[model samples]
Every structure is written in structure tokens, then in C-alpha cells.
Target chain A: MKNRNIPKKLQDNLITIGIVVVCYILVMILSATGLLSNLLQGLLVPLCAYIILAVSLNLTVGILGELSLGHAGFMCVGAFTSAFFSKCMENTITFAPVRFFLALLIGGLCAALIGFLIGMPVLRLKGDYLAIVTLAFGEIIKNIMNVLFIGRDSHGFHFSMKDSLSLGLEEGGDVIINGAQGITGTPKDSNFTIGVILIVLTLLIVLNLINSRDGRAIMSIRDNLIASESIGIHITKYKLMAFTISAALAGIAGVLYSHNLNSLMATPKNFGYNMSIMILVFVVLGGIGNIRGSVIAAVILTLLPELLRGLNDYRMLIYSIVLIVMMLYNWAPNMIALRKKAANRFGRKKEVA
Target chain B: MALLEVKNLSISFGGLRAVDDFNVSIEKGQLYGLIGPNGAGKTTVFNLLTGVYQPDEGFIHLDGEDITRLKTIEINQAGIARTFQNIRLFKELSVLDNVKVGLHNKYHYSTVEGLLRLPRYFQMEKKMDERAMELLKVFDLDGEADYLASNLPYGKQRKLEIARALATDPKLLLLDEPAAGMNPNETKELMETIRFVRDHFDMTILLIEHDMKLVAGICEELTVLNFGKILTQGKTSDVLHDPEVITAYLGE
Candidate 1:
């Protein structure tokens, strides 16, 4: 791995260093001024949510090789749970930042637990079938929340800005998410700093996992389940592990999403079918099994429709066409030709070395 | 103790009998061969032994313990490892990574260690890498360790598949077709490698090979199967020449 490979090694190291420097510059720009709120609201929040969405979905579509059409459902769980707690705790305690973060983590953990419960039995069904099962799971969760009574009615609590800044588990905060009106008058605490930190931490963890022996086992199972099984892999166990972890990450994203919005809606239709499909499009439109691709794709997709807002409804039609073109490009013989060329170069090196 | 003992084993899909009251035992440290034409229920026997399919009526003893209804992973953890007949390499993974997959059961560190990047994870990971390299060295695949499994020359991919199965440190290695697509020279070399692996691992081997010469040259004992029945059993010389075995297989 060494001795004869210094130049290649240097090139790789420089590329990694370049990425870090770029990320650092971006973070500084976002965090240094009053621009933090704009960054947090406009880009950072959605970026964090999408990264969590893409990475967690990797466990289903990438690791487990199952198609799940209800990832947003898990996000909805994290969002409402975190929102509920954030609302409940406001003004009742001091240093609410720590509690707020804890609430988010708790939301994630709860979502992960639900994922494990759903993944264990339904993972037996794969591909399109698995997707439908997950869709149903999401629907079931949403419906349960839809009819349940958790928070107080609107007439019960009055929320104020000064009181919100002193946010804690207050005896009375506010009840605003009253059937489609949405939770209003919630505190805006999350910033670009937190979003960037989370995105970086997530990338680091996911990259390391992909490079580990266990990660290799997971990827192998994804590629060929039967082949993996014959070699003594516990398919069900690995599938469950991947599914559980993916769900947990999705939960974390949900927390970020709920807190940033400051409103909680337990409505199942909010997450619904399209959200899952959009996330799937993000992962595949980028590249399956490639972390960098997923991240880049998430950022691009999140920004795409927003960037083209001036075009209005026609923008969406053009976006669909672009997507179609991208998928179709995969069919070109030249793309496959390039694949073989890379393969030949590597193969030749094996012979020479 | 015998490596594998299938006593009065039978399985049926509705009414079509897949394996019918088949009984056989493979001894420790012996190279045994199972040879039959297509549809002789040879792969079915493998499935039953490896816990792919549960027998409706039979007892499977590995090292004298009944493993009649164990899950595939439990069976593997109990020291029975196998390679599929069709090449089943993890196509997208690097060659070395593919082999390291078999070492998962042996690596007992917690997932938390990996997530946290603890010092213990580095130690275990290094050890895994070393062992994976060692296996690659044995098969002359160390040079191609980083190449994707699918990118390996076809013959090397097959060998990589076997290396992966061996990574489990099994007491009994079941090879579905260890020499399926080899040139004559490659097949001859494979015979030596088979012998080397058996001796080096100090393990019993049960192989399903279509090539009669390879089976005759390497196997110490042979079981001839026909239409889900044990047609004959003995040394390669005796069994290959048995009147019933020849007629049942060749229609002679």
C-alpha cells in the first residue's frame, strides 16, 4: 500500500484537504454575521434534513437493497416529537439549548425504535414490495398521531417572544398547530453553525462506516444476498442493523426539520408518498452506494427548485425533463466504454505490479 | 467425530420429493466428493446441510450435535461453511473486502466501537486486514486485493469466493463446485490447491464437482447420487466403475 505509491497518495491527500478547506470557508461565511439566520433558514436547515434523508435511505436502498417509500414518515415522527417536547419544556427551565438538543436526539431515538419494530418483520419483503410496506408503516404512524390528543388547545396558552427566548418546559408556552394552521409563535434557536456541524459529523461517520469491514459486509449483502448467505452472512441480522441505523439517522434529520420549522404537524399526509419518492430520486439521481454522490445530489436537488423559482410551474416541468435526460444518459455506450477503460487501467496495473 | 451426518433425511415441495430419505456421513479430515448429473438433488443436500432448507424428516449432526433446524448463521457459527455452485462473490466490493466478510462472526467488538472510532476498533480492524491479506497471499490474489470482486479474471473470482468461505474458520468446508470453469491447466493447479487447503486448514471437505478426473484425483471417498437417491458409495476407482453407478449416470 506504500513505498511505490507516494504520488497517488499525495494526490488523494491533497484532494481531501481541498474539500475540508472549502467546507471551512463556507462555514465561516455562513456563521460570521447576521447572515446566520438567512443561511440557517434558506440553505443549512434543508441541507441537514436532506443529508439525513439521503444517508438513512442508503441503509434501505443501499445496504438492505430494499425500496422504502416512506422515509419522510420517520422524519415526521422526529419532527413532531421534538416539537412537542420543545413546546412543553419552554420557559420551565434555563439553558434550554441543551434540553432542546436532547429533545431532538430523543425524537431521533424514538423514530429509530419505531424503525426497528417495522424493519424486523417487513424486511423479509424486498424491492417494490418493501416500498409499499414502509409506505403503510408511515401511514399507520401518521393516522395514529392524527386522531390522538397530546398538546393543549389554542385557548389554553399564550406564547410571547420574550418568554420564548427564555424557553424551557414552561407550564404554558402556546398551542398553535391546530389542525392545518400549524404551530406558531415558536422559538427560532437553530443556526447555521449547528447545521454545518451536524452535516460534517454525519459525513465523517458514514464515510468511516463504509470503509470498515462491517460496511463491506453490508455492501456485499446488498449486492448479492444469496451469495452473501452461503459465505455465512446472517442476512436478516445485517438487514435489520442497516435498517435500524438508517431509521435512526432519518430520526435525527426529523429533529432538525421540526425544530427549524418551530411547528409540529402529526398529519401523515404531510410526509405522505411524494417526500419518500423525492428522497429516493435524490439518492439515485446522485448515485447509489456512493456517499459523496448522495450528499452532492441532496444539495443540488434541495437548491434546484428553489433556484428556479422565477420560472414558476414550468420550472417543475423542466426539472422533470432534466431528470429524465440524466437517467437516459446512463444508457449510452460511451458511458459503459469509459467504465471498461477504467477497469482495464486497473487490471493492467495488477499485471505490471 | 464425523464432520457431517445426514440420517434418514427427506424434504418435499408439496408432493414433489426433493430429497428422499438420503443418509450419508462425512468423516473428519477427509476429502469427500458428491457427484451426480443435474437434478440429482445434490444442491438440495447442500441446502439441508447449510440450513438453507429444513428437512421434513431427518437429523443433521455436525461434530455430533444435532443441527436439524438451525438458522444459516447459527450453522455457520457452529463451523460449517459453504460456497455456492454459481459464483456468488460480492460483485461490487474489493477482493480483500469480500474475504473479510467471512470474518464478521469472529470479530466480537461492539458496533459502538466502530461508530466512535475507538482505539480497540483500530486494533481489531488491523488484525482483520492482516488476516484478509494472508488469505489473499495463499491464493496469489494479494496483488489484486483492491480490485472489485467482479473485475477479477473469471477464475480468480471463483477462487476469491472459496477464500471468502474459508475466512469463517469452519471445521467443515462445503464447496458446491470448486472447479466449475477452469481450463485443463487451471483445473490441475486447482487440484493441488484443494489438497493444500484441506491440509493447511486441518478440516474436512465435501465437494460437488462435475469433472470426474478432478474428483477421482482429489477425493478420498466418493458418493454417487441419482434421482435423489444414493446410487452407490466407495472409493473413486470402485464407484466410478460400478455397473449401477455408470448406467445410472451415463445411460450405458
Candidate 2:
């Protein structure tokens, strides 16, 4: 068979990439035909952002086997840093694409740096303790962003934790970040096409990492810490690597998110523990460690509420039901056995044909 | 010089001395056995030697270098590898990947190379696959390379663990209770595998086993531990026949 030529891991990765590509093509056709709704069109960029968030979180939760509740905190860090960079360089960088691209890099790197710093001490705690600490960190980041104010004038950029007036500016100083209001007038540079490209890049990075030697080391640490150490896999190094990379990817998603909206604020609804839990919901429902599943789940879940707008009150009821069903489908022992048997039967039938 | 040497290795848990003033010397390519009663500190010695537990008062020399204070990964890099008393395979990973993880330090490619799928990544991965498969074939686990480690039958899991340990290319291989849960038929087969490993890999093995038949059948030297101290140490046959050892095991 032609399929036998490619390695199984490669084939799986290609299928994931193919799924994103196919979806993009379908969306493009829909929009070209003018059949796409306004609401759905607006949801596209955020949908891509959520997919990236879900996949990146899977690296920490599913692959590294660490429970982190501060994912949105990293996302918050990325959004603010990248948004701040883009705002400051908006007139200087002139070109929109170049500015957004640099913002993405800044966002990802900033998140990664923060992730490494936090991971140094936080990763030392496992299970519930790690989750709680991350949760606190997320809240702390969001709270800090709330009180923070920054302005620019003749004396370079001024930073203040108090108020905008405290940032003693020279002549005509532009208030870049007003406390609680966040950065405004950010160029709406994010689009559906760029989001899809980022999703593909994220998938490529995650899937390739999972199959590589470093990926093996990370997964081995997850599987058996003692055995991994005994076999010469550095435990702390792999854990931090996975955590930092995961945070960086989340930051990229944050960059996409920040640029999509005119005003990007670190609100509880957007950058709090609730937001982290929502992304985690996508990862868990999609099947932990299953990259393709995360993509599909993010798309379906993001679109579900909008698609079910007519139901109004019953929309969330149906969403919760779907969550339960998906959990059972992915994790329930009996369901798993049934799935295997069904797959085997189908395989045998195909062979017979 | 011996391939592995230890002097006054000891560790205590709270008020309890888990292992006390332990010492051993194993020449290259020799099969050494450690035996003792149920609570005897056999596995603790393996832990100390492998750097799972740093000795409270002693030193370990592997291949003529002091690895006494090295961490577990450093100890493995310094040429000591071990299997757990209970099989500790990467249960979620493929059998091949389990072995590949052991080949981690032996092969090299930057993380960026791995993520970007660079030329070096492909070259090293191909080498890793071949080496991992060769190790699996040694344990006759080549056919099940894609099988999850947890899916393997118990005896094969044991063999896979040994294969994984050997993949690190360690100078000293420590197998803790290799025949703990094996049937006699499987144990007989394992004894042959162990012997083959010693001859083929030129490995120096230190194993803890309750199965006297497997030990007596293959071990060249033996140590008997009782109540955190060595009761006897000598040839396998002589240690097994020692009266004090018999009393420690059977009770007078």
C-alpha cells in the first residue's frame, strides 16, 4: 500500500496538518460564496487562538503530565508584552505585517522567559500544589496588569504601578496603557489566514517535538520519573523545556488574540483562571495528548454556542452534555474497548473487500 | 581495578538504618548476585549505587571514577544503569521508544534540530531507531517494537527493562529482583538471557533476586545481607551454603 511508505508518526502529523488545511479551504469557499454569517466570520480568529491555546496546554498537561492552572497567566503575559510592543512601534514599524510578526515573536519569547522563571520554583511542586501556584500566578498577573500604567514622551517610556499621571512625561505624552483600561488603538492586524498559519506552525512544532529524542525524554519523565532519571534523562531539564515551550506557544495564541480586538485588557473573563480552565476543557474533552482532537474540539466548542444561538437558555445545557459525552467517549474503559472492537471490525471488513 | 567498587556505603531513613556500611567489588564481565531475607536492604544498595539515594557515608567508583555524589542522570552518564525492583518501563511509550529514551545520552541533536526536523535530527533519529531495535532484538522484543510498554506480557516487560538499561551503554548494569515474579520456565529462559547479555555486551551485572536457582545457576560471586549488614560474602555456591546465611534466611 502507498500508505506503508510513510512512517506512522509522519502520517499522523500530516493528517493533522491536512485537517487544518482542509478546514481553511472550506472556510475560504464559504466566505467567497457569501454564505458565511457575520457572527461566524468574527469568531474565526478567536477560534484559531483557542485551538493554539488548547494544543499548547496539551504539551504541559497531556505530555508532561503536570497540572498547570496558570496557562492564561502566560497568555496574559504574551498579550500585554506583544500588544505593548506593537503599540509603541505602531508608527515606527509602519508596515502592519512586520509589526504583528515581531509582536508574535516578542509575545512567545516573553511568555517562555516567564515560564522558565516560574518553572524554576513552581515545577518543584507537583500535582495540586503546582496547579494552585499557577492559578495564583495567573491571578497575580491579571491583577498586576490592572494596576499598571505606562506612557511615552520625550524621556523615553515611563512605567508606573500607580496611575498614568505618575509617569512624569515631557511634552505630548501618549498614554499607552491606562490602568484597568489596557492598551487601545492597537492595529487590528490579525485575520483568519494568519491564524490558520499559526495553527499549522503550532501543530508542526508540537507533533515534531513529540516524536523527537527530546520529546521522548519529556514523555519518559511523565511515564516514570525514577526510570527516566536512571536512564540518563535529566528530569528537571525536560520538565522545564516542556513547560517553557508550552508557555511560549500559549503566548503566540495571546498575540493573535490581542491583535484581533481593538482593546486588549487582562480581565478576569479573558485572562483569569476561568479562561485557563476553558482552554483546559478543550484539551481534556479532545483527549489529552491527542493533538488533532484538541483542534477539532476547540473548533466545535467555540462554534457550538454561536451555532446554537437560537436555543439561548438551552445552549449551555447542551454544551455541558456534550462535555460529559466527550469525556466518557475518550476515557471510559468500556467505551474505549467498544471503539477498539469497532475499529478492528472495520479493518477486517476492508481487508476482506 | 574492578569495574565497580564501593566503600562503606550507607543510608538511613529517620532512625532506621536502611543500609549500613555496605561494600562490594565486581570485576569486569562478572555476574554478581545480592540475596537476603525479606526486609534485608538489598534494593537499597542498588538505589545507593545508582544514586537514587546518596550514601550517608561512603564512595562509589564505577570504571575507576568516583560517582559517589553524582545525581541519577549523572551516575548513568558516568556508566551505571539500573532497573527498578518493580518494572518501571515508560508504560505509555512504544517499546522502541522506551529503549530510545535509554539511548538519549548516547545520541545528540539540539531540541531546535528536533523541532525543526533538521538534517542532524533525521541522521540521529535514524541511528537511534537502529540502535533501539538492536537492543530490543537482543531481548527478542523486536516484533513488539510498536507495542506500548504496559501492553507487554510480564516476562517480556522484565526483558524490555533490561534491554532499556543496557541501551544507556552502562559499564555496570544493576537488575533488582529480575526474577521476582517469573515462573520457573520463564526464570530458566531469563537466566540464559542474563548470561548472554554478560557475554555479548561484556556487561558487569549486579542483581538482587529471591530466586536462588536463577542466582546459583548464573552468579559468579554473591553477597548475603541481613538486618542492614552483610552476613556473608563469597562465591555463589559458598554463600548459599553458609550456615549464618541459612540462619538469616530460614531462622535457626
Q: Give the worst 10-residue stretch by lDDT in candidate 2 chain B.
A: B46-55
lDDT of 2 by residue, A208-285 (tens): 999999999999999999899899887888999999999999999999999999998889989998789888888988
For candidate 2, write residues B1-252 as lDDT tens digits. Answer: 999889998899999999998999999999999999988999889888877887889999988899997888889988988988889999989888999999999999999998888999989989999998899899999988888889899999999999999999998899999998899999999999999999999899999999989988999999999989988899988888998988888888
lDDT of 1 by residue, A1-353 (tens): 22212244336434543564486577677677655555334667767778768877876786557788889888877777776666666666446578667876887788889888988888776557677888887777666555444335334543333333332334554344343444544556565557656666666566556666566667888888877776667777778777877887887787777677755666533465667767887787777765666777887787766666676467547557766766665566887787778888998899899
lDDT of 1: 0.76
Best by lDDT: 2
lDDT of 2 at B50: 79
User: What DockQ does each prediction reach against the true complex?
Assistant: 0.52, 0.60
Error of 2 at A284 (Å): 0.5
Q: After superposition, how far is residue A236 of candidate 2 from its true place, in Å?
A: 0.9
Worst 10 residues of 2 chain A by lDDT: A1-10
Candidate 1, residue A73: the lDDT equals 83
Candidate 2, residue B222: the lDDT equals 96
lDDT to native, each model: 0.76, 0.91
Model 1: iRMSD? Answer: 4.2
